[model samples]
Target chain A: MSRQLIIKGSLRRARFTLDLDLDVDLSKPLGILGATGAGKTTLLRVIAGLERDFSGRVEFCGEVWHDGDHFDRVPTHQRGLGVVFQDGRLLPGRTVESNLAFAQQRARNVNAAVSYEALTEALDLNHLLSEPAEVLSGGERQRVALARALLARPRLLLLDEPLAANDADHRQQLIGYLAEWLPAEGIPLVYVSHAAHELAQLTRQLIVLERGSVTAQGETHVLLEAQSEAIDSVARPVAAVVMSTDVEHSTATLQLDDDVAEAVLPGERVLLQRELTEDSGLGPALQPQSDENEG
Target chain B: MSGDLQAVWLTALLAATTTLLLVPLASPLAWWLARSTSPSRSVIEAVVAMPLVLPPTVLGFYLLVMLNPESAVGSLWIELTGDSLTFSFSGLVIASIIYSLPFMVQPLQAAFRAVPESVLEAAATLGAPPRDRWLNVVLPMAKRGYLTGCVLTFAHTVGEFGVVLMMGGNIPGETRVLSIAIYEHVETLNYDAAHVLALGLLGFSFLSLWLVYRYAGHRFEVVRG
Candidate 1:
């Protein structure tokens, strides 16, 4: 459908300079993969027109969103965008319902694929609706933020770790929901995450960034497989399958191949390997294939 | 109305007018002071805050020099409205606005600063334009600031004396405010009338400050600059 998002710019920060010149097709939802301080968030900020210091051209779907000059540029609000910041950034001193209402009120008048009731239900936000946004946990806040962004009915969706704060079950559920909803609605998406499995399931094309520059770019699975092999060579890894998840306790029971089951804690790092399953309605199930150097 | 009654009415009118006018005028200036990173921001802030530290007579002296009928702004006002800018109600309104500017701006600045930039960016990405963001997001978050600014401005204008005496010079039913009336009563040794007006002012000041603290929950500092 020729949905092109072109960004040719350089933004300088105190830590590092983010320089990029790329023309990406948004038809296959794009994913930006990078480590911390790798300019993933900065790149998303540039595309959303949040970085006013960015100098160059940003054109989307034949529209000139930015063109180097500070005065002459399409502002972020005018660009028909739905951006979910990493922190959620819900309006303070307001309820979750009010925050959602804020987006719904200003939503573009188009053929919306998802209704308010449906989105709230899908995100499991009916209980948290009356709660003030300030009192929400990180996971609850992200769910509300994701719902709010979808409610905006944006032409382009930019999500920066929209589900990172969520527990494994909710994260998988939302990723599955978005992987389906975005395509059905034909909304071009630019998702940023450091999780390889997330990018594999949600996005088709991937751009890996390192130190504010694109280090690798290709089809999602192909690059991920190559990256996995490279990591496998360095560290001998053990394969494990998630048997059950305790969302309340933020722990997951992983059954290793030798029949040894270990309950992994919340903040533990585990490498997720995508396993293709035909019967699993939710896309590919992310099997926790390895704990780094635990073999 | 009696002389004292007229003075009271005039004082209320002046305070109301100054408060209403300063709300719009100080909003943009305060917003700028809250957000801008320009080198000149401090200079502009200092100028806006001059009335808080400078003696009212010093400000009144400069205002008198600048707004006398012979001065450019005074002559322009005379030409436009057929009235002198000195010893007039209009003159008092202008002087009061300047005298109460810091009262309005400082509270609003602090309030605007309290609003996180991330929230504003979130509002923008939600399809709200600049005006919509300002009205819905900024205004609601800064309501306490508006409350503080309005109460302080109104109370400060009501208590104006030195500036009014120097510039607007106690013209009955024109510029004769409560403070000026009290001064006249004391000068004439009418201690009863002076006592009545003085006590009213003291009560009003205390009440205004109390309202600021009670409702706005602000520290109610006069030396915010």
Candidate 2:
């Protein structure tokens, strides 16, 4: 239960330096929302032990992995981090099954919560196992990559804009699939994305990064209202209540500021219910009673 | 006639030995050449490709001097094996390996270079060590380069005349390779025998190279360093 991640580091390069001092609770999924050059990917890489040119002390789950100058940093392979890069980064020469099996073979600890059978089935990769990784479509490759990373039984999963490479339809499908499965898996995740809606679909708590620094860190709804409005010019955040749900028709009725809007979407009713129902135990605490509603 | 056949067999043996030794020897060098960003990378690469730029006689001269009984390498060989390093089958193999070094390394380096870093990083994150990643991921992805390096090494060693002549003199059943035999045949005015040997070498070279270029060479043509 003590899944605390403390990172204090200063990564210096020729033209840029990212100084971070963060203490994040890793029991729930944490979203990292940032625009390009915000050092979102670099933060993930530093935690995953892929970027080592930084001076830092990182302690996760009460174990110190980096101690600034004296400690011998744990190498990337030994860090037990499941990283799903934005590019999918599947081994081109291996078949999809081989790629998964490669991770399975190296899994040091098999978390009972995440099994190979469940992951393969959940990712729907049974039929595409024999196909070469290079030949898979963008969506299929990401699925296989996600499955492969899970099969490694990592202690912490790091996803860097995984849906950025997919088409809109594939992105929606993937997001829905992740929204359903992420809470059930019980593995801590640091999901990095530039889109607020995409991160909102997975986690409510988020840290907003800007120019290699944290500008805001709190619940998604409040922080987005303050931070995102200043950065994003084209899109504004909207608040609405689900008025009614049509399960058979896969539709939902929302009351936004006295304006009624009906949306036809797949699984929209169920998604809205999950978002609104506090009984689900996975949804964030949404209280509209507080005047401040401060993050 | 029997001498010519023996020369043919010796040439095959020398080429085979050089190719077999160079595959493992050149692979690490090729990988380093392909991936290393160290300051010594250019220097190491120049040394590897020295055989291609320098005349064969120059290489032959240095190798001949180095293999002298009084030289360090020659003395080390003498201490280990109690035999001279020059004018022997072992000497021919060493000379051929050096003479055909670039042929083995250049193609393999290019192949290793073509492997994307992301794929290797994925392997690393999957708990594979550097050696395992090279063997499992890199070696398979660069299979064409390995094939090309092996074929070229074997063919180049078989066809070498200058370094073999200078370093491993025509000692029958010892260093008398096919090229040397052909040279002797021509010097002795045995045009008929020389024609046969020359034609055989020409035919084998063309076929092996044609087959490599037809199959694996296309992969190298587009993606090369």
Candidate 3:
């Protein structure tokens, strides 16, 4: 059966509104690229059936997940989804092992490509199994969250910045792993990230969202090349790390390679450059380089 | 002495029964109160908390009136079980459940609220149905809340006086619980007997509160997305 995802919906908040009408083929992995507050996460949430207030229809693979009417909808759990949220919301007060087990026990009985031992080893979660989820570092928590989501054996996978917390090395390693693993498993994926190269590496098709609207949609490499060219023409780009983000204010604290830190506001052009280092087989390393301009 | 012992046993049984029943009964209600965004949520909350502030006699009086053998529910009970609901053991159980509702509900509500919507959403995406999420994700994380609620509800039920007196009327084994027994001891000027039961209750209440504070003091904190 050909995998198809159709979403036609609009969600209204006090300060922002998300309006979308998309019909995407799931033959290849898909990516959603956007800045903070560009409705990327909300779009993922709507697909997962978590956005109850969303008024529209969501159909996946000939199955109606949600209809325009609030009452006529499949709840989140029934959607056969595996979502790795940005924050890695591990079940609190439990060991990492228990968290993974919770997903394994509830997983759909499909012939999953990834085994428990292989997943744990690949994710480097064996040592952290006994550790409480609350005590894990940001990167560690995200890894556990990823492993847990996979254990559920979902038909569709939705990842929102899944590698955003990891260090440069692990981030590259995970991206490579996912790029290989997802296709082998035949699980259709909708990956969301602000980092352009990450999307360029893992996805074939891309959708760029800007202020709750689809500004561009096409092949991932084509769009990224165009965006990179657009950046190359006008601004001096410097490599920086997004140390912390303030979504309410639409700002981020970027730690530059020169050891200088700067706060960036909305409308500032921050380009993520893919640095091909000596260990090139791992994948392109993302270094967020910014061009500051007054909005 | 046997009468006093019977009263103590009855009180324990009543408190146990009320706590057991409230676990299932108050769970959905508390979950709704914790999560519902409807305009009527505040109204439902206030009603659930009415027993907390209202005088026990008032609640007992209404229960007595509503559940009397002549009334609809009471008559239905009479037909079903061939027994009167008012001034009976079952009547006392119903009153205790209402009288101690806030004790059970408030803690459970706090616990359910502590289980973040994000975590529940994550669980749902993992193929857990609603009931599974509630059992595995919600109940385990809300352990302290259940502990606090169960202890408080049991303790509060044991401390009942006005409601039991008004509804059950000191029917020894059927309803004359600890507080009522103490009241009778004081009424009969049996100072020695009253002193024993009152001191026991005072110690019991102190321990329950102490357990709640010592164990459940720190709230369950989840990493938010």
Candidate 4:
């Protein structure tokens, strides 16, 4: 897959200094995982052209948005990228329909085509179109925000803990929609979150950040396998996908590390320890063919 | 007694004119003061709010000296418009705008401040330019502030006496407004007409403020929520 976004910059601030040299593929969803204050949000801001106090270069699809030598920086609006902030950030004065309309207008201004009607319908927002954004519930607001951003027809989508406000049911439904929608639409997604389960559900590739630095970058499973020695005793759990659920036996089968095992299913994605346990029946004893235990 | 109509009309005219000019002038300044982190922002803010504390006559005196025919600004005004700046309706309008500047700027600044930075960032990321965001997001959210500012500035300008009297004096049909007219009536011992004009102004002010507080107060409640 071709690289869609390349950002190399050094941002100096009083709180922290972030030195980033990141190249992201356009084909797969990239997950940004970091602890609180690890510069995850700052990284998104820099890439989206929101933070311009940095000296470096940002190239998107062969066009350079910023160059340190020339002091050239494109503003966020012209970057053709959609962002969903943690607060939802819906315009309080506008109705839900009007908010979507404004994004549609922007898409048209940029010569990008977006179907607001289809998007609103898909997001189940047709019934709430006339309601003012201030009255929207947290889940409803996030859905509207997501739909509004998608209606802008951005080439890349940047999400900064966008669903943190949503309840579990809503978050799951929205995540399921995104998992299906993003891949089908072929939009490059850069999802940032402190929640392991969120990143696990959404992305195959992971960029693990710590103290304003990238500590690991590779496939999600591989990075988790290497994560323990990479950082001492920070057992960031790896995600296990549920393959099948046997309701009769009250045990679900999980697929992790090329090994199938029995486990209880509380959700589509569940966190699993690298050292397997007997309750899940996913110990190394059950996986003799796997080389993950070698090194 | 016939002059009461002219005073009423002139007061309305002055207030309307000043409000119209001040709205456009104060909007950008208030927005900048709310959002700017430049070191000079505090300086500009202090300057804008100086009129709120300074005696109106002091402000009027400085304006009088500045607008006199011999000063740089006064000479420029003469060369451009071929008229004296002081003792004219134009001079009164200028003094009123300066005197009422804080009434307009403070409210607008507060309203603009209430708009969260995240909303503007979302607007930018959604492809709205600065102007578009202000028009679509900032303007709508701050509507109550605009209304409050305009009403306060108009009411304040209508009730002003010292600045108008010192800078423009009483030139009937030209510089004489309701406040100056009422003062003149009191000075000449025409208590009946004085009481009439004073009561009329009192009633008008009470109504405008009541209406504004009633409507704009609710908007603030909504904003806070």
Candidate 5:
């Protein structure tokens, strides 16, 4: 498909100016990585047509969304863009079945997209059909949210921190879903996130945003290794986790090599198991926390 | 005296009709005022909500002008339906809708606006369009706001008199609503009949508000505001 989104210009809004300009050809799911307040959400809003306070051009599939001269501010609903919020905005008034039904109500060509039954099966949303959206867990909501979006059959799909509100297991589930589904559909996705590590399972093409502009944008592996070096750890490989907790013991366990690596516990000397060399002292001075889930 | 059961039925019918007319239009306009970013958004918002700030007479006067048979608006209406809209049931309905606009909009707007943009963007990325977003995403997420707006509009319209009085004269079985009946009785020193109508309006409004709060509190904290 010839689907791609291009946004360029200085988005000046009061003190918050999203000056970063970008043109991304979405053959694969591209991660828009940034720290908090880095305009990741703003960028997604522009593409989704929810935000318009900027002097620039946003073209999708060679169709102009907003070009200063040819200003076509297509309303969000007509833009054919799908979004998944941190909390799944499933209609609580409707059951999970009705939620999908509501989305299917808006599909321009409903026959072109996957049926709700097929999507429910794809995302494993069968049991939650009768349940009210409010009662669903974070992971369940995320799954249903994905199902809702897929049913809409959008031109561009946008995800803003899909795993931020989710627990580790839920995050893992969504990542697994993304890996299996996004490529199959071949629809372009601009995944916005604060942490790059959460995108580990997905494609690693990165657009590292800082302040309001892109500080770095390239292949995931290159950006990760280069960034880890540029950061506190000088020129070292690193693995990062989105979760942080105070372990009771003086040691931290890292999951690797089909087992847990405790401060004292041992694992295979697989070099790939190591991330960046850093003050985190991953190789030593770390004790394994109990309840370290191993796959 | 509404010692006659027919009057009671008439009043209930009028109140319900008024509520039905106000909810849908008010909800979407309210959401737009509270969330949209068009350059002229505030102008449209201010105009939609002007009834809240303007005197009831001003609104009533303008509406009366539009429906008067000798005027251009009345001429257009005469052309379309061979009748004037003023001092009629539809006119009263129109006046009541305007009077109750803010009541419906404020609650729904507050509710829609309260939804975190982050949550919405997530849904958009997932592939929801405007209709799907509102139905599957906005409305369900803002259930408290929607319910609050509906009940408030219904109750407010039920107890309406001012704008209705200005635009719709006391024409029994046509434009004569319960509030008008209560006012008519009070003006003519018919305290006994007035007492019955006033109490009915009062008790029912209280009960409506109470029921809404009771049900909504089970799902949301209406007071945390």
Candidate 6:
């Protein structure tokens, strides 16, 4: 599974230049976390072969797509990648099924891991098949976009701030859904986000981009555990735990993950355990964790 | 009444022919005017709008001269088609197409311009080529502008008298369109016939336009380019 993408390029937009030097191996979901104007989307555009004025070399899965020295630049359509823009750019005139079908037609290079049926079922889009894309809710549109990207069978999936349009509940569900799906299918993704708090639950690989360059690249868990100099140069520490909840704020317990977890108290709760031991299955599913200790 | 009916049918025929010529030519020109950021964009835009600024006679004069089989463009076209573009119904169509080009394009370009780049990119990302992107995404999204361009081209061609007089030379049933017939009626002091023809033109214009835009989605009004 040597599905990896290595990109080094510089693209000039009106007053600023986006310079990226990155190596993203297709092993797990890769997160490019940064603030607005960090050139995160610009870098994604270069990867998708949309921005042509870029100078660099890009190799995906041992295939060279760009070699700057010889004036080799692949056009965006030929690059064989999938991209999810921040705008959830759905086709307004197309039905949800047609939108998904369009992606299926284009993704010649991708392996068909997720069927359109599975996508509609997982994203709960069965009722939306005939409706125009413009009529969908924001969350529905976002999910449809994600489903469309997956159906394209892309070797590398690029998602830019997909959760920005979602509310708290939708975001939480989507995070859990992506975590369960992206890893299980072994599909590699480059998800851009400004919030480290959001990226933590997704993957451990974090690359911090600033101004127009990479300031730090490491595992998210490692980066979250310790604030590095390169990261601190452009950002301050964000409060995070391997698994902590402010259950004390409302005195409600909820089960989140299962690795090595005991029940937790309201304040210092780490990972939630599966044993609230109430009568209904909802107790365990909705049970909150309580912990009294930490490192 | 029979005379008025004949003239009305003649105008409708001219309008239909003009619209037929507008579609293929207008689409490419309108797209270039709407989307291209190249250095030639302003030049193309100016060329498309030339008929709007130039006097109808001057445009008609140049067109007459250009289609005379003596000029290079005319000679080439004449050699290719074996028929020179002068005083013929086809010639009238060609002249009317040029005169109404800007009317066809301004609306269409505005429509194409209103389509978001995000949608185009989304189609590209989904594997549609540029041609497919235009046909599937661009055309469908800009349906209103296309409809407007068609209507305007037809209306402009129907009222076209000056260009037809200069280039077409007003031969009955060949180039003596309803507008020219009305002009002839006025010159002969036939106010009743002129009034009949003019009213017919007005009614048909209003009715045809109504048929096209009357049932258009109310949403189209506020959001249209």
Candidate with top lDDT is 1
Better of 1 and 4 by lDDT: 1
Q: What tens digits encode model 5's per-residue C-alpha lDDT throughout A1-295? A: 6667688887788778888578877876788877678888888777777675667888888888787643556666667866777667765455788767666666655554355666787667888788877778876787887777777777777887766655554555667767777777666787876544555457657898887898988898787767654553443332433123322222344554355444421121221223213333443212222223221
| Per-candidate clashes, comma-separated | 0, 0, 0, 0, 31, 9
Q: Which residue runs does candidate 4 get wrong by more than 4 Å?
A: A1-3, A69-71, A108-118, A225-269, A272-295, B220-225
For model 1 the local lDDT of residue A19 reads 95
> Candidate 2, residues A203-272: lDDT per residue as tens digits?
7789988888888899877776665333333333356555665544444565667787665433232233
What does the lDDT read for residue A283 in candidate 1?
Answer: 19
Return the candidate ranking by TM-score, descending. 1, 3, 4, 2, 6, 5
Q: Write the per-residue lDDT of candidate 1 for residues B95-157, one digit (tens) a residue.
A: 999999999999999999999999999999999999999998898889889999999999999
Sorted by lDDT, highest first, which candidate order results? 1, 3, 4, 2, 6, 5
Candidate 2 residue B140 C-alpha distance from true site, Å: 0.5
Give per-residue CA lDDT, model 1, range A150-193, as digits (tens).
Answer: 98999899999998888877887998899889998889999998
Per-residue lDDT tens digits for candidate 6, residues B101-201, read: 99888988998898988898888887788898898788888888877888778887888888989988867767778899999899999999899889988
On TM-score, the stronger of 1 and 5 is 1
Tell me the whole-model lDDT of each prediction, alpha carbons only: 0.86, 0.79, 0.84, 0.80, 0.68, 0.74
Instruction: Give the per-residue lDDT of model 3 (tens digit) for A128-212.
Output: 9988898899989999999988888988999999988876567778998898899888899999987776887899999999999
Give the higher-lDDT candidate: 4 or 5: 4
The TM-scores, one per candidate, come to 0.89, 0.84, 0.87, 0.84, 0.67, 0.81
Candidate 4 per-residue lDDT, tens place, B19-77, comes to: 99999999999999999999999999999999999998999999999998899988899
User: For candidate 3, what is the DockQ-based docking class?
Assistant: medium
Between 3 and 4, whose lDDT is larger? 3
Judge the docking of candidate 4 as incorrect, acceptable, medium or high: acceptable
Chain B TM-score in each of the candidates: 0.96, 0.93, 0.95, 0.94, 0.85, 0.87
| Superposed model 3: Cα runs more than 4 Å off | A236-295, B218-225
